[model samples]
Target: MLYGLSYIFTKQATAVASPLALLGWRFLLAFVVMSGLIVVGVIHVSFKGKRLRPLLLVALFDPVLYFIGETFGISHTTASESGVFLACIPVAALLASAWLLHKYPTRLQVIGILITLIGVIVTVLAAGASASLSLIGYLFLLLAVVTYALYSVYVDKASAYTGIEITYIMLTAGAVVFVTMALIEALEHGNPQALFSLPVKHPSFAVAVAYQGIGSSVLALFLSNFAIAQIGVNKTASFIGISTVVSIIAGVLLLGEAFSSAQLIGAAVIICGVYTANNTFHRQKRQSQIEKKSD
Candidate 1:
């Protein structure tokens, strides 16, 4: 749900700060909070004896590539267009998980995934956005989807790592990459000092940064990794694109955006899809546990 809110606050942050600047501080703040948690013994991460390849790849795929693509893609495209693109994450994630982790979804789960995807397309297109973006924009969005999928699959593959550990490294990498990007952009504009001053000057950026850095980056990514570890990727990815629905609902409730009947129907379809997929998985899980206990 916080991912949905990230969309809303991202608009606010972008209004006050460049995308790279906003992402830099957003993740830098998250990294700071994560560091404090480690220092305070609130969270623990271990890197002893484990090869760094999987962890590094996971971080590279996620906060690094995913954000770069997503940030730029949304910038060049309309929000509704981006929503339709974001809707493809679960399907891509599912395929990646199946190929990489060998975690195939049940037929019923695939149907549910398709249902949710159709609902997202319906909801997004109901806004009547024309398909009119440059090829580069479309390619960026595609990169975002593919990188996000790879991230989900790698997180599941690296099941030895705890959620805290995965999220810690992801945020650390994000902070470094985005801060450097922000620095480069600032330099190109001949205003490097803006990186430090602009965020402090804008109250809107401050509020957006707090929520995005803490709630969305730190907590949400941790939960996502935990879910992927526990439930495997496809099941967790089933609800991946539901953020579009949540963003719409949030806009209606918080920002007083108009909510249409088609949107309401689309939201219901998404919920039904998620519930149907997870419900079947739980039932099968329980049945297997019962059989094991009987033996």
Candidate 2:
């Protein structure tokens, strides 16, 4: 939920602050807080051999590259369109998993994915006729989706090697990347007129960045890692829909955004599809266990 709210606040901040600046500051704050945890004996780090290198890479892809891309992409697109498109990430992950595992989805699963896809398309088109965004921006958003899928898979794979610690390490690495990029951008563009000057034009924007840094980057990553540990990757991935629903509510209630009946219906269908996708796996796993016991 914190992760979902971060997007809303981030979009708000992006209105007043440069995307790179916002990202840099958020990660810088997260990095400092998390690193303090490491030093204070609240958290521990292990080298853990070469086995968990992929977790670091996934971090780089996700909170690092994906964040930067999505921030800029949202600048070019409407919030409604971006929200709907982002919700389709789980569908993409499911498709990617099917291809990589050579595990053809059951008929029911395919139907669910199709329903979700249709809902996403409906939401996108119903948002506005001028809903079109630049192709490059959309491509960046797609890249964000691709990395999100990879992040989902990798977090699940790396769960055995100390879940919370591993997550903190990966986030720390991502923070380092963001900080470096921010510093480079600062060097190129100059000192950004000082942090004190930030509140003069946009106090809300400053508050949003602080919330994103502490709540989303640090705390949400911790919760996600714990959730992935408790439930398997497929189950965790299904819950990505929760973030979509949260985003929709935030848009309607917090942002005073309105949607057409078509979009509402589509959202409902997509929610159903998400439920189906999750339950299908649960049923199949139970059936396999039952057969094994009978044998």
Candidate 3:
């Protein structure tokens, strides 16, 4: 649900601030809050001897590119539509697994991916350009979804790092990248003071940033990494619907976003395809065999 609510938060932030500035504050706050916890010794994340390459790539893909694409996407599209587009992550992960992990997708998974693509097309056509859906927005959301899939693949590779360690690196990298961009944007606008003054004028930005930093970036990321470690990536991907469903409901109820019957039908079709592609029974068994052989 945290991931789902990220859209609502992103949408709210976008209304009050530009995308780069929003991401800047969100990830900066996340880095500061988590860093404070470390100072207090509430948690520990040691990376001295651990391999950092894979986790760095995970950070790049997720909290960096993922947030940039997602914030921009949400700015251009309805939160509900962003949620639907994000539901395609599992399908993207299927492909990523094939490429990164050398785990070829089964026929059913391929069918599922194709079905998801069809659903995406149907939803887009149903939405048209008239109904708050922008082609640019959908394309950015697609980029975000692909980054998330890549994140999962690399996180699987970086099994040596604990979840909190991974989360810390993500927050650190995101803060560095976005804060710099935010500064550059402020400079480009010749209003450096606005970086601090904008959020002060818009209190909603602070609220949204807080939720995103503390709830989504820190705690939720840790939980996701833990789940992936415990149950494996495919099983974790199977639950992608939980976030999608929550995002849809939150968009409709909280934001009063209106969606059409065709869009609803497309969402259902996407969910079914994601479900089919993400089925883990035989895949899990096979993955275990592969792991054993590798070990």
Q: Which candidate is the best by TM-score?
A: 1
Candidate 2, 163: how far from true, in Å? 2.6
lDDT of 3 by residue, 1-295 (tens): 8987887887788787788998788889999999999999998989988887998999999888888788788779874577568767877787788788887667766776667666655665565534465999988999999999999889889999988888899999999999999999999999989888867898888889999889988889889988777765665665665565466668889999777898688778767767776675567789999999999
Q: Distance from true position, residue 155, model 3, in Å?
A: 0.4
Clashing residue pair totals per candidate (backbone < 3 A):
0, 0, 0
On residues 71-187, what C-alpha lDDT tens digit does candidate 1 reach at each position? Answer: 899888887888899899989998998898787789888988888898888888776777656688888999999999999988877877888999999999999999899999999
Q: 119-146 in candidate 2: lDDT tens per residue? A: 6666656776456557877877777788
Global local distance difference test of model 3: 0.80
**Candidate 2 global TM-score:** 0.81
For each candidate, give its TM-score against the true structure.
Answer: 0.96, 0.81, 0.79
Sort order, TM-score high to low = 1, 2, 3
Q: Which candidate order results from sorting by lDDT in descending order?
A: 1, 3, 2
Tell me how far the alpha carbon of residue 228 in candidate 2 is from the true structure, in angstroms, after superposition: 3.8
Stretches of candidate 2 above 4 Å error? Answer: 48-52, 77-85, 101-107, 129-133, 195-202, 281-295
Clashing pairs in 2: none
